[model samples]
Target: MTSVDQPPAFSDGAAVIELLNTSIGYGARAVVDDVSLRIDRGEVVALVGPNGSGKTTIVRGLLGLAPVVGGEVRLFGVPAGRFHERWRIGYVPQRHTVVGAVPSTVQEVVASGRLARRRWWKPPTAADRAVVSRAIDVVGLVDQSRASVSTLSGGQQRRVLIARALAADPEVLVMDEPTAGVDVASAEALTRTLARLVEDGRTLLIVTHDVAPLAPILTRVVAVAGGSVVGDEPARIALSPASALAGGIYAHPGHDPHHLAPDDPAGPAPGPGWLGDPGLRGAPAAS
Candidate 1:
């Protein structure tokens, strides 16, 4: 992939990913509408919402998997549609298993992530091998590098997928449901892996339904519902255990603070200010 010769005037140098008043969906249907968001470098942002609430649609749109029907999406100061440096971003889709119909070793699977950086016909070089090994080590799977992916537990397999993404050494890592369906121990391990990535100054955009495990490390939390962002706040405020249990912030669409009855006695009914809204219901438009 080649780089853009000149960044468009609309590009924001401070933002790694910017979605300006964007709408996205399949074909003619728009699942997310007029949404604007900016993710800066070194930020760990979590997209939290119930299923079908457009969280995945936003991520897919950023990745160019879904069609953007309105506005623009930019990556690293270039229009996403024209951006050719795809290796700058690494993706880990929701996992069912690391091994497909054909089982591969953990090392082999992680090595595949480097395919984007190397020509298919060229054999792996020493540097490529070292990078792959480092990726595996980053995810804490070095000991299992030679094990068949199918033989590992669900959490270990998830790490392998992460290691594969890390192998590319992308500027940003976008993960969908990284903790989904894993045991507590596995979830903790995943969190530690992600924490390490954060310490390395890598930007991350994670889509998840459960945020408790990742709450401590998240810099920001964005709540999505009804095809729009409903809440955007610093993680300490949005994902706090108290706020979450009170249905105050980062609550699922079904439990939105606005849905609470005024006289029901679970604290006064929430208003626009509850979500840190500054007039508009969601976050202020990205500058």
Candidate 2:
């Protein structure tokens, strides 16, 4: 079994992620309201909010995955719509639905990340091969390089997805619900790997309903509510017992905070992070 080691990648110490009054949703009914955000190099930001509060919608807007009704989003300071520096950005979709039946080996899957690094119709360059191998090893998948993707565990699969993002050596990596249903060990491992990325100054923005798995390592948190930002503070502040209690739940099931009436809770309440034990992977999102 070949052992793969982590690599020192880069995020250029650049402010590569931003959103300005960004609004997004299906059809004409907007779910996300005008909101502006910025992420610099060497920082990690988490978006924790009540479900349907437009956290995912905001992320989709930045990725150009969802149409924005107002304001603008910039990647590397260029308008996101016209941003062609695809090679510099990496994204891990919330659903790895495409992995289930795929019969490709781990190396093959990681190597595909290089397609974006090359020109149209050209063969893979030796440098591209090196990057893919390094990416595989960095995500601790070297031993499974030749193994089929269908054979890996859920945690391994998630790591493989992240490796593809890292393989591209992107300046920004945006992930949605990255730790959903993940086991404690796998989630912690992911957090540690991400922490290493921050030490190396690679920017990361993750959208998760639960912050407990991510808070200890977070540099900041952007809490979304009512389709707009209600709080933009350090993770500790945003997830404070006082704040968390009043904020309802970030990513709670069947949540629709927009229509739900509000009432201020009288006192601080226990929560995912405030429980004092680094809790386990949170409840799963409904089907």
Once fitted onto the true fold, the runs of candidate 1 whose alpha carbons sit more than 4 angstroms away are 1-13, 241-250, 253-287
The prediction achieving the highest TM-score against the true structure is 1
Model 2 segments more than 4 A misplaced: 1-14, 96-102, 239-287
By summed lDDT, which 10 consecutive residues of candidate 2 come out lowest?
1-10
What is the C-alpha lDDT profile of model 1 across 169-270, one tens digit per residue? 898999998977775445555666687788788888999876665655777777887788877666665654455422633345433333222233432223
Q: What is the lDDT of candidate 2?
A: 0.68
**Model 2 CA lDDT for position 218:** 70
Q: Write the per-residue lDDT of candidate 2 for residues 1-287, one digit (tens) a residue.
A: 00012111322345677776677777888889778777777667787777678888888888878888888788887888788987787888786433646599888888777778788988888888888887776667777889898887777788788888888888778888887767655665576667666666677889977666565567667777889777666555555646653355433522233312222142112353323223222311100
Q: Which one is best on lDDT?
A: 1
In TM-score terms, candidate 1 sits at 0.80
